[model samples]
Target: MADITIRLYIGPSSSDLRELVVPAERPLGDLIIDWKKVYLLAEQDSQGEMIRYQLYRESEGKKVPVDPKKSLRDLRFQAYQELFLTDACHPWWQGTTSQPTTTSQSKAPGTAPLRGPATSKRVTTATTPNPSPSSRPLPSFSPCSIELAPGCVRQIGETGVVINRDYLLRELPKSVSTLERTLMWMRQESRLLAVSRSDNGHCSIVWKQSWYLMAHHPVYISGTKYSRNEAIQIEETVTLLLGRDGWPITIRLHSTSITR
Candidate 1:
């Protein structure tokens, strides 16, 4: 069967965003299984049983419920399209798992910036405990949601860091040099998580108390080759795994070079 990856964006309209990757060919019912394992959203019902979830289509700014019996192949989504699913009844604000916004900030000139939803809330140690004096979780960093794009070659100090090439070539805007620079800096500063090759030659990372997997396509850099297909495979594996948790996975091209 031809392999394909589906990128899923999760979280809320205000804050808390995450991404998941799933196999395009999988049955729609698989999304719930994946989400629960990855995000830990599956809470026990009154009888102490895991609750089921339903997937929905967000079309024309309205949420239309969908049948789990359908195959994702039937949906025929374009790359980087938005899709959503609903879990058991939770607060409206709490239920929102993802939101898409313009890369640029929405701010007025010559004015103090508006505080995000997280900052506006009364500080509670139960929800927003201080990690440290210098380190606190930022609203932008949702471990569940990921921003997928083609990886780019960036210079960090003396070393060069390369991300998925197809993603940069296909998804990233050519005019966004500043954004690219910022991303490079984040990676260099270790603020951005790395999915490097492990001793087993697999790319993976531990996220949200679980081990999520990754794969890199082979690209030749300075006569050295990195595997793109392998990376894609790793991403596919992650999607299938996350699907068992009742969540959707989002995959964007991180590199173009299949053999570089």
Candidate 2:
């Protein structure tokens, strides 16, 4: 039999989209498994994770399931139909799927099987204002010599306290914006990561490879610490450093006197 080709779209309906092609004879379930591996969304749970998918005929409004038993050739799916797949937590919007009415309550409420952890709460940190166009660029300096002040410190389980904000505006590089863009890229590249709070009290944006810790209190230091008043500056700086380095750094608070 001629190799059949199947296209897959993985991500939010709005943005951060991705695509891949697979053998047409592949089972729908196996295709989803392959996608999760490629995207790093295959988080394991006691029960296997559920993946929701939507398969459509090219250019047509209607959607149909890509059954495992049925070959893609049999489905007569067009050259390019919209195919969306995401971890169970991020279910594809099934406009075509009908929801059973309350009157037909065969299953108990909340008894339905869960796919993954619930969607994370969105955090809306205030953005720092952009510098005026007339502002002169600062001279280049080594990132190592620039000592970051300890940010807000919240104790972790027992041995650790995380520093959140550590941005220093005056010392920051002109290329800092590039760092922000890089983070946006990282977030898209790694969809499994999410914003979470560590057991102690530290808040961070986490991914498979690293976590960006946030300050519990603004940090104030020059030479020794970056100023705390510039919350946006600190966050942007930390984000840039972590994103670029591809390694995790621990922000520590030595004394409780630090201001929140």
Candidate 3:
């Protein structure tokens, strides 16, 4: 069997994305350890308490907690999938298992811009009628969504941007930069969500879906919903794009396997 590919966005921001390649049979716990090493997170207990990490998979527009024991293939994680990594201790993280525990003086390397998510709890004090202000839950952050720019979307060379098909096909002017080709490739792979090009011409694509296409030569039909004609057209476009030379691009391709 071959390996699988997935992308990890350090946070809600698109700027902190990183691609990871690992064995398809690898356990999620091992993947987490790899992340810790890459980010230089300390394994030693934080403060005086033991620190635990939780993994999450962003699916159907929701953050689904992942079990460390499950393998990537066991979880049915498709290629080009994206996952979010956050400390389970964050005040805003809904996955909190208990009261927040403080970490050691040395913070994790990939510090979040702010505390994230939201959840609630009830505390009873012998004499107090109201929960103290400090005990209240933090406000929820913006719901996770794809971040796209307005007008002709410019592609960041290292981290290619995702755009809607309608915008890419009609609104986006032909350009030499990575945007046009990136958009074309995304559309071919069914990663580009189609939307009306409004005054701003700005729209959101499934971030996880976008990164998957960039990392893998997608073959499975489950990752996308497309008509037979659309699929054929996409293949044709891909052929045309690959036929021409001097495009000056580098992308990773992953192996494939059939699940039982």
Candidate 4:
């Protein structure tokens, strides 16, 4: 059988995104285990630590959970599609475990930014308690939703200036430099959560979980789709904006898998 093409997103963020071509012979679950060995070692679990991951295939504008035990051949896998791999136990959007763990935060209004990465013991989000004073202020995030493309509706907030859909990862615009610059101006961030599956009620932020999962690609700023070619810009922009807290704060890109 011919190899199937997949743009595998290790997490909700685009930074861990990778396109893979693989044989369709093995079960999806088995493949995922192997993929981790080859591509990701940073997530190595400690002794007796368990990390739960969920896979979803974007089809007809919906994210359908995949049965890892099923083979791609059995699923009639297609070529060049987006596959999202996320932590099922700790959803990125929520940044907390299925069984929530409460982290202590200062009870002062406006003392902390509602959105950001989680600390060793804190998972910050609109749902979490106020962060401590030591926590830095995140950029003012203005989030808006739009539609024109199918299978893309998750909302990712913006950092500095928002770019129009024309400049997203969709069709090429008149200038590549313009697109690059547009992306540069666009902010993105990392939302890697730090929850241990080894035991419940023992969750803490590692790699620091963040408060925002912007659903970036589909809902960036406002409008349209983004072409894969422009995806690299997404990466660079994230890196550039990560530590910046000036006029233009960093952005977090949380994209839904688009079906096409």
Candidate 5:
């Protein structure tokens, strides 16, 4: 994999941001090792080597810790993506030299376990500010997204809106939004190569994430019934192409699937 340059945040503030080029194939843990080499606080404390660090990134409006075992490529990280390689014991945030200690326990509830060793010195770190509700760009398209099916008690994202990610869109929010989210869901679930929507609202979801998905004729797609519009009959089994895992990735259902 080629190297990718990402915006790296060392401290909680914007000034701590830096552009760093990292190997796209390297595990995230490598960044922590590199951090120890530069951060002054990485030096051995009185009790020997002490102080821990971790990488975190913004996710759905929260600063979530990234799995150090995962590589940048595994995460489908985009070049513009930013990362938080934070130092929890930096002098700007540190307030004690009392006693150096080593333990996996978190000083307080609801905090990540210390990476290295630390003393009893307790300090609150600055939290990244939450983005404004309207921070997302306004859409410019025919809106179409998922919504509660009449009276069905569906838990937020449990619907097909989010086949993979834990996010949900409004019912009939935007068709583009549904298409984007559906593609993402397919990618994580199987070897999805492509997605193409017909003239109707129903989409052709073809992926290698399943074995042989042989349904009866007039199969229900996106909750709408559809029959074969092609020459293929109900007795025929249409094959979806390009199988790395196996067959059954392509489909030819057409207009009948959409509710006029």
Candidate 6:
């Protein structure tokens, strides 16, 4: 069989959409390594830490990670499906304090000392924000940054739009009237924002501390009804969230379902 062609959107913090043609049976692990090579990241960084990449696909307003070991075709990824890329060890949204808090005098209880010359080298530290009343201090920088753009739901579709909160704040209108008017413009297109869920299964907006799922009102994604107990019989498109943990990290949606 001939090689398959697919479009991929790769980003750590910021994403760029691109197209590629590769063997249909190639494992995603090799593809990630190839991307790393393109970016010129060594197998291990200067700190002697192995660099690992995580793949994610946007589904049902969530970033669902893709497994690296599976073949592209086995994953059922269709042509032009968008995929996200990020460093597993050093996610940009997470803080730098992930490193062990240790001192030359002594190690913490149950903690092991750093091994080898890697310990001697000083790594770059990310700026940390002050801890909020409800949240721990957030990292100022992550290995990956999400790229967000201002667009209404009508433009992006029912899955909902993903935007960088910081970017939105910076680009927000200075006047309340402008903000209200802009939101009104968006409201004209659609209501009912799709809430974001964390990897921990908590319903909270990423990178924001004060926000939480205060209330959930069941609103149909489509005019039709759906149930987990029943098989989806309609030709209409449906985005199903499934995974071993049941965290809804992977999406299975039919592409041609839109046209039919």
Better of 2 and 3 by TM-score: 3
Each prediction's total of clashing residue pairs, residues at least 3 apart in sequence or on different chains, is 64, 9, 3, 18, 9, 8
Better of 1 and 6 by TM-score: 6
Better by lDDT, candidate 4 or 3: 3
**How well is each residue in 146-240 modelled by candidate 3, as lDDT tens digits?**
21223433333223333333544543445523465576667653223323233422222112111222211222222232221111111101211
lDDT of 2 at 100: 28
- Return the TM-score for candidate 1, rounded to 2 decimals: 0.33
Cα lDDT tens digits for candidate 2, 1-260: 45544445443332324434556665455455445445555243223212333343323444344454455666665554456554343233322133322233232222222233334222222352324324734322212111232442223322223322232222234354246446656775421122122342223322111112333322222212212111111212232232222223334322222121
lDDT of 2 at 220: 23
How do the residues 75-107 of candidate 4 rate in per-residue lDDT, one tens digit apiece? 887777667665544334344232111333223
Candidate 2 has its poorest 10 consecutive residues by lDDT at 226-235
User: Best-fitting candidate, measured by TM-score?
Assistant: 4
Score candidate 4 by lDDT.
0.40
Reference-based lDDT, each prediction: 0.36, 0.34, 0.40, 0.40, 0.40, 0.38
TM-score of each: 0.33, 0.30, 0.35, 0.36, 0.34, 0.34
Q: What digit string (tens of lDDT, one per residue) describes model 6 on residues 1-260?
A: 45777765442222234567877787676676566545543333334434456667668856677777687788877776666565554343233223211122222222211112323432323353333334743323211111222221122232222332222334444463255346656785211123123222211122111111111212122232222221121122323222211112111223321221
What's the residue-level lDDT of 77 in candidate 5? 87
**Selected candidate, larger lDDT, 3 vs 6:** 3
TM value for model 2: 0.30
